[model samples]
Target: MPLIYAKDGAVATFTIDNGKVNVFTPEMHRELHEALQDFVADPMIRVGIMTGAEGRSFCAGDDIKTPLPDLTPHEALEAHFFPHIHEGRTGLTRPGWEQDVMRFKRLKPIIGAVDGYCLGQGLIYLLLLTDIRLATPEAEFGFPEIAYGMAGAGGMTRLAALIPQAVAMEMLLLGERIPADRALSAHLINRVVERTGLMAEARAMAERIAGHPPVAVRLEMEVTERALDMTRDQAVDYAATLFRFQRVAYQGYGAGTGFFGTKHEAAE
Candidate 1:
């Protein structure tokens, strides 16, 4: 299988192993969508770690060697107007996996371990899918689609949201690869480590997240992602509502005294 999904305790690991650089195909995208669905539905899985199978690359992006299928005019129109209708069918349109993955209503947090080339679709996944990221010193990050006369709309939009406009524009317009250290400086990745310790660090972070209250962790993820588009007052109000709901549903935490905890009350 090009994509491998495995579970260890509360942690789920997704490894992309298509080729030396782990370029994705339509089949791989379908597999990834199924894997993410499984992860979201499985109550036992609390956190996820995504990486390439080998140390060569996290992912180089889509496989250019794969031939594009010839589509009829009607099929092309269906592809544009009703993409999800072709979910089980392939070759007629670009798969809607990107939107499906990003709009997951109950997505668990995913940590990215990037070792080498993370360009094009790979960079898009890093920007939108994963919550925390670790990269090796030799890792390279960029959007190479612009050079080929493609806009790479997915990566460009998400990258601009994450980093400054100037940096995002430079990357999108020039198609230049950024080194791991440069990526870290730009706040694109969390840390730059040796290839040997990359997965280890990622796993450790996943485990730490898994140890937290699952509902609280999920609440944090939802609030933060949604808050990006919310006004400050709206964000605070939304968080307060969710916080109350979680406390009521989970019976609170921290020595059974609610989110404030006994220590906080004692100090008060």
Candidate 2:
């Protein structure tokens, strides 16, 4: 009827619970945004996972038709949808709906456990909202906002920043739904899994990330975000001194750095 948003330890999941298609309504958006805000604020939560109930959809996008009139007024207002129409755009911040899509500067990473039929704003959010996108082989991604006579403002710009130019053009102009394998090949998705093990693999990934030094990862993301807008030389100069950072050494912040003080740092 509406939607479900729940948090468990370092993982918070936002599920599209409005029937099979998972249409984005106002309430659904509000609930999801609030849950994400909570996850972002929680020092104990290091990862967030997004999923849907069942069938071929993480979310099918906005409701194309009006709600059924047979039910009471409350039925028509059961869910709070925002992606389609909200304070995220036009510089407007409605009650309980903050500008999250562009301000997900949380202390943790958000991961999307993508499965079938991720379309329109759903794909847009997956492209920008999630730091890591792990898709099932059965998953498909698209942006059909143009077909609805509206521009996919977020996906239009964010997809290009995330993926190559050609792939971004294909998604923006042609309006085709790309499969998971294709998406992975284009670097649109980070990992691909068999449909049968999608959730398990995603949870495992979340757990692995959650087990790492939380503050380091958070600062890494934040610093890199700042670096993205800097000149190459400037970014390089800044990175030279990044290793001296010791704020993450506080008690309870230990991921032990493994053999090298941090998973990401070791990788570097």
Given candidate 2, what's the lDDT at residue 66? Answer: 36
Per-residue C-alpha lDDT of model 2 across residues 125-208, encoded as one tens digit per residue: 676677788888888888777766777554444777877878888887787789998999999888898778887888888888
Best by lDDT: 1
Per-prediction tally of clashes? 0, 10
Which is the leading candidate under TM-score? 1
Off by over 4 Å in 1: 84-93, 96-99, 154-157, 252-268
C-alpha lDDT of residue 158 in model 2: 70
CA lDDT, candidate 2, residue 79: 22
Q: Write the per-residue lDDT of candidate 1 for residues 9-31, one digit (tens) a residue.
A: 88999999988999988778778
Tell me which residue pairs clash in candidate 2: 25-80, 25-81, 26-80, 26-81, 27-79, 27-80, 27-81, 28-80, 257-261, 257-262
